[model samples]
Target: MDVLTAIRGRRSIRSFKGDEIEPEKIEVLKDALVWAPSAGNLQSRFFYFVYNDDVKRRLVGAALGQGFILEAPLVVVGCADIRRIAVRYRERGVYLYCIEDLACSIQNMMLAAYSEGLGSVWVGAFHENEVAGILEMPENHRPLAIVPVGYPDEDPVPPERVAHKDTVKEVF
Candidate 1:
C-alpha cells in the first residue's frame, strides 16, 4: 500500500493471526527505523526484535499483562542509546531529542509494517525497568515502546478522535 493509504488504514491491532512475518519484510521494518530522521542526525534510537514465545510472555507481564502481546509473532522494541545521545548532543539530547527520535523511528517502522501487509500496535504502557532487564538492555539504553507485529485477525474500528475545531487552532 501507498504511504497515505497506510497512514489512514493503520490501526492498533489487538488481535493477531500469529503468522510468521517474512524475513524480507522484517528487514524492511528495520530499514525504516535506521532511515528515520533523527534530531541532529544523531540517530540514537535502536530496536530489538523478540520472536521467542517465552520472552513474549515476560514482555506481556512487564506491559501490565497485556496478553495480546504474547499472541503476535514478533515484537519490536524501540530503545534509546542515551549514552550516545549525551555524548553527541548533551543534556537536551538525553532528555528530549532521544525520546522524539525514538517516537519518529517507531512510527516509521509501524508504517512500514502496515505497508507490508502486517499489523502492529505501539505499546507504551509498560514497566520500562522490567523490560530493560528482560531484554538485557544496557544501562543507558531505555526501552521506549513495545510494538507487537503480525497478521491481524480482528478489524478494529478507529476510536473517536477530537474534532479539528477543538484540537487544531489556526493563527494564520
Candidate 2:
C-alpha cells in the first residue's frame, strides 16, 4: 500500500485476535524500527518484544490494568537509551533527542505493522518506573511506549482530526 494510504487507514487497534504474527512480518516490524531516522544517527533506542503470558500480565498491571495488553499476541516496549545519545549531545540529548529518536522508531513500527496486516496501539498511559522494573530494563533505558500487536478483533472508525486551517500555521 502507498504511504499516504497506510497513514490514513491505520487506526489505533485495542482489541486483537489470538493468532500469532508471522515471523516474516515480525522481521519487517524490526526492520522498520532500526531504519527510522534518528537524531544524530546515534540510534538511541531499544525495544523488547514480549510474548510470554506472564510478562504480558505484569505489563498489564504496569499499564494500570489495560487488559487489552494481555489479549494481544505481542507487546513491544519502546525505550530511549539516554546514555547512548548523551555521550555527545549531553543534557539536550538525554532529555529531548533520545525521546525523539524513540518516538520515530515507534511510529515506524506501527506503520509497518499496519502494512503487514497487523494491528497495534501506542499505549503511553503506563507507569514508566513499573514498566522498567517489570522488563528488567537497564538504568539508562527509559520506557516510553507500550505497543500491543496482533490481528485486529475490532474495526475502529477513523477518529476526527483538526482541520489544517485550525491546527496548522504558515509564518512566511
Candidate 3:
C-alpha cells in the first residue's frame, strides 16, 4: 500500500485475534525500527519484543490494567538509550533527542506493522519506572512506548481530526 494510504487506514487496534505474527513480518517490523532516522545518527533507541505470557501480564499491570496488552501476540517496548546520545549532545540529547529518536523508531515500526497486515497501538500511559524494572532495563535506557501487535479483532472507524486550517499555521 501507499504511504498515505497506510497512514490513513491504520487504526489504534486494541482488540486482537489469537493468531501469531509471521516471523518474516516481525523481521520487517524490526528492520523498520532500526532504519528510522535518528538524531545525529546516534541511534539511541532500544526495543524488547515480548512473547512470554507472564511478562505481558506484568506489563499490563505496569500499563494500569490495559489488559489488551496481554491479549496481543506480541508486545514491543520501545526505549531511549540516553547515554548513547548524551555523550555528544549532552543535556539536550538526554532531554529531547533521545526521545525523538525513539519516537521516530516507534512510528516506523507501527506503520510497518500496519503494512504487513498486523494491528498495533501506541500505548504511553504506563508506569515507566515499573516497566524498566519489569524488563530489567539498563540504567542508560528508558521505556517510552508499549506497543501491542497482532491481527486485529475489530475494525474501528476512523477517528475525528481537526481541520488543517484550525491546527496548521502558515509562516513566511
> How does each model score on TM-score?
0.96, 0.98, 0.98
Candidate 3, overall lDDT? 0.96
Q: Global lDDT for candidate 1? A: 0.92
Measured on C-alpha atoms, candidate 2 has an lDDT of 0.95
- Please state the error at residue 149 of candidate 3 in Å: 0.5
**Per-residue alpha-carbon lDDT of candidate 2 for residues 24-119, written as tens digits (9 for 90 to 100):** 999999999999999889999999999999999999999999999999999999999999999999999999999999999999999999999999
The candidate maximizing lDDT is 3
Misplaced by over 4 Å in model 2 are none
Q: Count the backbone clashes (under 3 Å) in each candidate.
A: 0, 0, 0
At residue 75, what lDDT does model 1 achieve? Answer: 94
Residue 166 miss distance in model 3 (angstroms): 0.9
Ten contiguous residues with the weakest lDDT in model 3: 1-10
Candidate-wise lDDT, in order = 0.92, 0.95, 0.96
